[model samples]
Target: MMTSAKREAAPANGRRLILFGAFDRHNFGDLLLARCAAAGARTDIVFTGLAARDLRKFGGFHTLALADAIAAFGSEDADFVHVGGELLTTTAWEAAVMLQSPSDTARIVALHDRSPDARTAWARSVLGTTRRIPYIVAQDDLPTRWRTHFRAVGGVAFDTLPGAERNEILRALRTATTLSVRDRTTFDALRHAGVDTDLLPDPAAATPALFGATIGQRGQGGEIAALRSRMRSWAAVQLAAEWGDDATLDRVAGSLLATSAASGTGIVLYRAGLAPWHDDLDTLRRLADRLGAQRPVAILESAHVLDIFALLAEACAYVGTSLHGWIVAHAFKVPARCLVRGPADKAARYTDTWCDVPRQWRTPEDGPLFPETISG
Candidate 1:
């Protein structure tokens, strides 16, 4: 490990680095990405939609204005710019926002997502405007769509390794300045693609300070404190509306009630989605009302992500239709089991280590043995 003097001296003479990402939301997972970015930034301004009330949970930002930073871009003073660890499938507003004002001398760097399908067409278009790109978390044997996109964008080289099997992917890695990957799938893929693999964990996992702070704040007694403190073995439940299966929701509710009843602990249900698809609240409300007569259930209708996370921290275990709920529980070291209804790939990709249900936890003949699995 480097000495304190070396660490302190590292950024003393380097140019200011401007970091950017889709941090303008109330999602805890997104905040985890922002926290990772914050941990590395020497001096930075964050452009996030996170309310001032919740921004305090992740400290160390120089400026926390959403509008000014989004509007002005950068001050043309930084040496390099980096956007880390977010799926860029939507419109390229952020890339447009950041590149709008660029320092004449800044070298742009990016942390690429692991999946080939994660980046969208608009993202490729916006990133294409940059000079030769330097990639982070760069994968070998990228899907043709991404490979074509990178080639069109005048891509220079990759710095990080991810696995690939396609000769094209291996050929691409041969040009990377440095290389590493985080998953065995990627490792074998890259080895097949003919590139050396050095496994590393996802960048977001490296920053525990923010996650710790979130738990610390939750520990402080307040509006939810009474409920949080009263609950010791409650399990967290969350689901999305896009699934559109009322029967499934009912089953989940019944499972939660059974869990609560059997374990002798309250049940905390979270409405974890945001607008256009913020179906969790209404769905959870209906389920809570139905389960209330049978068992004590606490329905969290809060729109703030931290409040939900704080509540999750109090749970003994978590079972959820929302992937992030399981992730948050796992982050807190609480046992988590995912209730997957739709695509199993995403769940399989991320939750290989967690207890997971390839399908809904409950089936026609099943009482959803989830309570026993979760409480156990």
Candidate 2:
């Protein structure tokens, strides 16, 4: 269990320890980082700051530059300073740049581990620098080269993959300051490597409650009832059009239509991610046309992330291509069928760790894993 920092003495200067992260955007995944930091902090000296480039149109959180963040760390300050969330792998330089800031005073904690996307040249450059980072409390799905590189950084909690790089990662994790992983694969890998590792639930498991609380805070809890009242049994359908073409989406829509007909369930089409590179608004429109009034489908192109989750909570089951969509559905114990778009998709990786049933569908016709007729 993670313990709270009990500082012997208060800081000489009365400044709250700043909780830093790459929350420059409105991504709920990053928001989870800030929420976890808030949950862990003890003193009122808690300020949330974004270390990444601010892409959000508008937000109330404080933005911290490298210099400003360093100033917040008092030499004798208890382990109050935390660098939490998924910033470690989203943008290559996020972890490197955030940790590069000069400060030995604060204890920096990296909350979730997503190995850097090291396939790119820029990612490789950043991975080279990430070795300088001391410790990270990470998730299990790190890439091979990234894991091999992370070996030197030591303190990490990850799952082991079967590959040539296994030996190197084992050696690195063996010297780690702490080793805890979210999956049995990681635990077995570490044990086989002659290292001890503890199994823990992934951070994504905890976000539904946090997401729900965020919804209540925004005064949208009432809206869930209003939305739920519109449908008999809403099954949220989320797909990433960026990964596959229009044909792929048509297949998913067709599958959903069939399922709706079979189960008399209503359909709610929504987008979980808001990155400009991967918008599903147009895709949802195409899907609606495909459904063509056979079943009533509501389009939520502009729903808040928590609003989407709220709808999912009230959902009969969730069927989607978004990894977070599946994670959120499972977290809420809402029946879910995660559509794995690609073989190496993160959603598939995560499903392997958590769900015992065959929850992943490669083809739309493979059907919802937890059909309403069969689900409890």
Candidate 3:
């Protein structure tokens, strides 16, 4: 039995939190940080610059316009506001420059999760966006090659943030020393930036997907078998020269639908949304006939980091081309088999975390873990 007086005092431990990013979906890291930060404080999530339906369910939150993300902090003085900005792109579009903290203000910035495809056709444009934010609150990291780009984004000659290393800083913030990242590229970048970035794995299998045991001890059923079966078929299809065409995706979906019907379980599908290009929700609708219901698969369009992770966690395994999907899936210990081209940033992180699960990067049949590492 607790007394009213003691219960009344319970509110003293939690801190009022203000999170950035679009929380339209479940993100493992995002949810973890927000939950940890609000341990004792009554947090107020300022969904600034975002219009996500996923976040609507979060009560006692005030969704501010993008224009208000910065100003929302001091104007609403609840507690400290962490700088949750997207590191890969410096554009002020996702940063809070207008809400610059006082000279001594302590801010936390989220770093990159994508690899440095230095050949990325979008570098110069990203640099231009950095000029808008003008300065960095806390420079989180990504892969090594991407650092130069981050420096360039801020339009500076590269004067790094002081004492912001990963192990030390995350501890100092009273938070985990690890920050969620999407891939090895981002991990390498954070290592370079002196930040310890953790890879957010792709969605886990809805069923038990234990991979720590020996070949005979490994649990193989449900989604796991489905994955193995698909790989065999997909491999031959690839050898025949049909990979990314719409027909292949449908063939894969058919397998999943048949499995769902046999199991009498509700089927759920998801998209990584990491790449802004092909995450059209309409694609899911197109496959409605072959799905259990209209929501058979959800091609997540826009979601905050936490929302995305949560959504992915529900799926048994992730079979997608999105890099983030692979990261979040594996991070949650979910089986995420990628259909990517080759040694990609996301593939690196997945391979590093759980070598037992074959990454099969573009390789037809599943073999031992892909040993190829990311390098210069």
Who wins the TM-score comparison? 2
Task: Please provide, for model 3 over 1-376, each residue's C-alpha lDDT reduced to its tens digit, 9 standing for 90 to 100.
Answer: 1111111012123333344333222333233333333334444444432332334343113445433444444443232223221333333323332122222112312132143233122332432322322222222321111111111011111123233223333232222222344344554555555554444432232112331222123214434344334332111011011233466556655655554444333444443332222243445545444454522333333334333444444445555554445544555555555655455434444555545655434433233221122111
Q: Cα deviation in Å at residue 8, candidate 1?
A: 19
On lDDT, the leading prediction is 2
Candidate 1 local lDDT, residue 28: 49
**What lDDT does candidate 1 reach at residue 286?**
73
For 77-173, candidate 2 gives per-residue lDDT tens digits of 3223333332222333334333333232122223222334432334335344232222231213222111111110111223323342344444444
What C-alpha lDDT do the candidate models reach, one value each?
Answer: 0.46, 0.50, 0.35
Q: In model 2, state the lDDT of residue 46.
A: 38
TM-score of each: 0.60, 0.63, 0.43
Error of 2 at 67 (Å): 5.7
Going through the candidates in the order shown, the clash numbers are: 6, 3, 46
Please give the TM-score that candidate 3 achieves against the real structure: 0.43
lDDT score, candidate 1 = 0.46
Q: Candidates sorted by TM-score, descending order?
A: 2, 1, 3
